[model samples]
Target: MSQDLPTTSYALLGLLSFGDDLSGYELKQRADRTLRFYWVSPAMSQVYTELARLTKLGLVRAREDTTAPTRSTRRFQITAAGRRDLQRWLSSATVEFPALKHPIALRLLMGHLAGPETSVTLLEDYLGLLAERRAELQAVRDSLIVDPHSPVDRFRYPRMVADWGLDYYESERAMVVELIRRVAATDT
Candidate 1:
């Protein structure tokens, strides 16, 4: 069953496992808030399409929410089958190395043409942007609830992942600073 669905489908199932009956719009919002840090957040249209496919596969159950003040809205929750499939995929899937697509690195490789000044400027600008992103991710890390007394903290893993992202950003910032210095020292 897992082989039939794309990875995004599994991502949605994982989102729903948090125990909220969410509409497609809400799902997109959640993805934007969380997935953007580490993974590509699926477009709104993709969210709807995946939801429809999951519904057809009996992995998700959609029901009309009549309590809405305006027109009825459809909210979705993961079915038992979805949970089983997610668990199976998590346990059995072979993890692949993360693909790096660093635009800055690509540009830096051809820095001879752009000259040292341009390369220094590029690396400096990246530092500012990295700081901004790091702060935003830090805010997200701060917002997660971690209860030490509880044997099971649903947010424990999320907090760990957020910390990992924060560390990654810090490492990138240090590397960019070094690159800036190196470029500025270049003869050309």
Candidate 2:
């Protein structure tokens, strides 16, 4: 591993920004629920491996949770050195978002290479998936009675996440249907 650390290293550092000593599981949940909208997750092995590497580099420190009977249970904390490293990483380079290589985008780009029927089938399948996702999001959102001042809502990052997902999926479903109509008209 390079001394500079990978993208996930900064992700771990960013979680530490919340000012809590967290177990790996807690860290994973936070990343999944909150950071996932704008960040990628490393594999479970990669997370643990990076945590170990961060410990070795004095950027992170792990201590046994004495409150737990099992010594294997540990929580990690960011050191002053870790904070400095994170600051340096942030200042040194611009973060590059990963290029989207979505199946829909690929199908759209090359749909002309396929038969009209094939294109319609692909678009319909994608539309079905989007509709399913939108339904799930709607149900989840409907279940939540929004209380802006609720302490629970304040920390429920995933609710905000679900809201964004609902809007995006709805938009995508509409766009795909319109594109399909255009494709059909053009084929005639």
Task: For each candidate in turn, give its C-alpha RMSD to the true structure in angstroms.
Answer: 1.8, 4.6
Off by over 4 Å in 1: 147-151
TM-score of 1: 0.93
TM-score of each: 0.93, 0.69
Against the true structure, candidate 1 has what lDDT?
Answer: 0.89
lDDT of 1 by residue, 1-188 (tens): 64657788999899999889999999999998888888788999999999999999889999999997989999999999999998998897779787678888898999978889888888888888899989999989998978788788889899999999999999989888887877887854
Q: On residues 19-121, what C-alpha lDDT tens digit does candidate 2 reach at each position?
A: 7898877777666555654566666676788788888888888988889676667798888888988888889867686666688778778876886677878
Per-model clash counts, in order, read 0, 0
- Pairs of residues clashing in candidate 2: none
Which residue pairs does candidate 1 place in steric collision?
Answer: none
Q: Pick the candidate with the highest lDDT.
A: 1
